[model samples]
Target: MSRKENAASLVQDYAEVFICPVCGDTVEVVELKSVVCPKRHTFDFAKQGYINISTRSMKVNYDKELFAARENIIMKHKLYDPLHTRLLEVIKVEAANNPRSLLLDAGAGEGSHLAKILDQMKTVTGIGIDISKEGIRLAASKSEKAMWLVGDLANIPVKDQSLHTIINILSPANYQEFKRVLIENGLMIKVVPGANYLIELRDTILEEQKRFFTNEETISLFKQHYSDVQIEELTYTKELHQEELRDLIKMSPLSWNAEQESINEVRNREHFGITIDLAILIGKNR
Candidate 1:
């Protein structure tokens, strides 16, 4: 089957969870090519298989090349393998409580992380949503296991109390919308950068003030919204070759503002030692 057909089928299976982006009504799959709501707000599946479910046009800084670079760093270099493993373990604990799970990877960029997690899961239905069409397009091209959509975080396209788990990794969070879409006691696994995250790149490319990192305010805000909040700190160093180091620089926003000479300096390294320091916050919806 084509990606469009496969996406339609996936949406059909989980149509109950999706709502019309414009009218706020339940959506239905029609003619295997489009989704229509009661008020006739129709959205067609793109040729690449992902649907654009946002009400307005969006232009994001994360382009196709950026996503490609990110995919290379994550998939080829296995830079995030340990983090993915821990995410699977956390999701499994929640999956055991519920026989079947509907997981949404909010702000899922390129869907690599969600695709990897879904591969290890047997009974979880995965949905990946991002505002960047380029990221969602790249995601749809990779895996048909999850439903991919270009969506707004503040106005999520999913229905209320419908999700069993939400995984937000190194991405912004819309806590109010997230809580509205999650069922009672649903899991929220949020990963934020720790003080030493990407210290190698920061030290080389960023300003002194920008080199410092902290998530204390982020954690405190999260605690106010979630119950049974637990934080896990994962820290490690990964050795990178020249090409991997280049891709890492391309994929990170830390290098976005750096001078080309500084970027070139990091890219031209013979061997680079990078630190992956992150805090994983696991919590339940109140």
Candidate 2:
């Protein structure tokens, strides 16, 4: 049976072992009990079976046009294939040792990574949450098995210490929230842009755009929240056609900062290969 069916079958199984989104504890999952911990904090799951445990909701800007461009780019090609491959490899590594259970894709913009990763795993149910309504809508339509939520990362609305694995790819991360939501021995996977990720695009946008990206910084931050951090960088070049060129700019943050003249020049140029520097960091919750 599918994971959705499986998750439904175990509705009561979670009644006792719910992962508390606050304090990272294994809290009770009973209904109308007014969830409370020794610390005197309390939360309640909504009628929809989702609990809001996040500390606060963040202000996010998400427009249909921006998400539309992102959808166009992600659907057309393998822009994030290397990152996706690494995530599956890690998930498989974990599954080889035990049964795969719950998977969380935090900041899971539109669910491509979760869909791809779970497509390779067995008996894993996925929850994908992003603050962008547009993103969650895309994710909801991305697959049947993955439950999609329009939510924030700093305050994950989950049971504390309840998740098996969470993958954060090319997006914002809240290590504290992740640490809270992950079970002991749980895995957290994060991907960030390495320097030279879009050098051509960056250079076109400005002469000194290098100040914005730092893979080293990303690693440094992960070290604070997780133990045994591992970093990997994958590089490839894809010769671009006109349509791909358009795809490249539309989804790129660099494009948002580019001058109109440079944007016009990029549109006119014919061929270029981008160096995609991505870092994959995997660690256990401490």
Worst 10 residues of 1 by lDDT: 93-102
Q: What would the per-residue lDDT of candidate 2 be over residues 48-120, giving only the tens digit for each residue?
A: 3333444666566666666666766556666767667777878777656656477889987766778777776
RMSD of each: 1.0, 4.8
Candidate 1 local accuracy as lDDT? 0.91
- List the candidates' TM-scores in order: 0.98, 0.79
Query: lDDT per model, in order?
Result: 0.91, 0.69
| Candidate 1 per-residue C-alpha lDDT over 142-164 given as tens digits, one digit per residue, 9 for 90 to 100 | 88889999989998888999999
The parts of candidate 1 lying over 4 Å away from their true place are none
